[model samples]
Target: MKTAINTAVKTRTLPLAIADFKQITKAGLAFSVVFSSIAGYLLGADQIDLTVLLLLSVGGYFMVGASNAFNQVIEKDLDALMKRTRKRPVPSGRMSVPTALTIASVFTVLGVVTLYVVNPKTAMFGAISIFMYVCMYTPLKTRTPLAVFVGAFPGAIPFMLGWVAATNDFGIEPGTLFMIQFFWQFPHFWAIGWMLDDDYKRAGFKMLPTDKKDTATIIQIIMYTFWMILASVFPVTGLTGTLTLSVPAAVIVFILGLGMLLFAFKLYNNRSNRSARQLMLASVSYITLMQIVYVVDKFL
Candidate 1:
């Protein structure tokens, strides 16, 4: 009986622990962030160094995980108020604040150390991304809609951090990468905010550009998306440092941008939750495919 009870207890606890880990670290989001960073690394690398790639993948995930864990700790109460976030580890009572903090602290140290091994610049940017995300963007979310703008700074760092990891330098190449991601966040997040405005309002998060699902907000989303596409193709003009895009690759990227733009226009026309969700999905596809185009163009 004792052995059977222990077995059942372990079985129950194991899945809960895994759930807690995934919630605190936001595994899917972290993986996407790491994917962009790796794409940047590949773009900048002259020769693929598996060791550096391995280190970058691990370090990037750790850094994003640490940021997310800390953000959860800070917003535990607010998270509980939102239907979407209420089931998260901290808010749902699956994990303790202290435990989450400990995990974040450890991840931060490991991430920084691992990135530092790649280069000082990479580690420095990684640290800045964490600090800005936790100390600045997290707190500003409830206070102002400008929080998205502030968050963009840290959100854009991953792609550029990879380039710095490869070249150990900050230049136009990484700058262009940073700008591309920076502009991409507005439309991507605004689409999410449009879809979840109610949930966001329940938590008092000022996510929308105009603080309402209005024409102004949709206009801003369209505007930023336009700028994001322009930034993506700027490299094709051979103006952005070592980064260059082939004409065919540029055409493919432009077509991808158009697809996203059409979705944005759909949101503007109907202003329905479904349209917003479609725009959100399109935005994700746009960024991912654009990054792939950039990296693949370089090798071919």
Candidate 2:
């Protein structure tokens, strides 16, 4: 009788569990990663192959989703410590470990298999991204401030992975895409760290390079934002064969960089979370617009 009841209960919870699973996966983040990958694909492809594009989207979403689900599972205890994450499915007991693990395993197989259909290189990088996110970045979050820097590697891969998917090669063109997103991660995450410093501390995650909102940390943000801006302009320099940008587009890209830098400057001058929040919003706009600019520039 007890076994039958448990099975009936699970049947009822299936839909709810799926809902919680979406939250666990952080669907918005997965979408952003997919969008970036699509931009990379469009920029690299001589002629857009809709089939490959669709496969990239499906595979990228599940791969990122699996990584995020496992991250919640690993950090379930720590997550319950902070208000920001206390209500996550794993932490709040809305979903059981077994259920979350099942989701992760399913996504792992589905994502890798779908990406494999695109190309081995795409599949390999997708799998590596999941491994690094769950195995490397997740653990380092509590131990070292440098985790942010290390996390940047996998964070930057999707943009380049798009190129690899379209071309099945890793070259200067893809490297350029990777570098832009790589440098972009620093200031973006540091700003987020600034806003969530207290919550992060409650969880023992030393996200910011420095524990405090000091001059040094702000300087690092500025320096990385500068580097990101420089990297964004690389294609327009006529150095990259596949990613060359027209002069007009280069000018527009520079302006977008300035827009992001403006907020970075505000953060530096104020040294407050309010400014950090603004910088965070600006960073999102900058990266998204920059990616759109790159794709648009290709045609003109």
The candidate that achieves the highest lDDT relative to the unseen native structure: 1
Candidate 2 structure, TM-score to reference: 0.94
Cα lDDT of model 1 by residue, 3-101, tens digit: 999999999999989988998999999999999999999999999899999999999999999999999999999999999999999999989999999
Q: Pick the candidate with the highest TM-score.
A: 1
Worst 10 residues of 1 by lDDT: 232-241
Error at 215, model 1, angstroms? 0.3
Clashing pairs in 2: none
lDDT of 2: 0.92
Model 2 ranges with Cα > 4 A deviation: 1-18
lDDT on C-alpha atoms for all candidate structures: 0.95, 0.92
**Model 2 lDDT, residue 2, Cα:** 100
Task: Return model 2's CA RMSD, one decimal.
Answer: 3.1
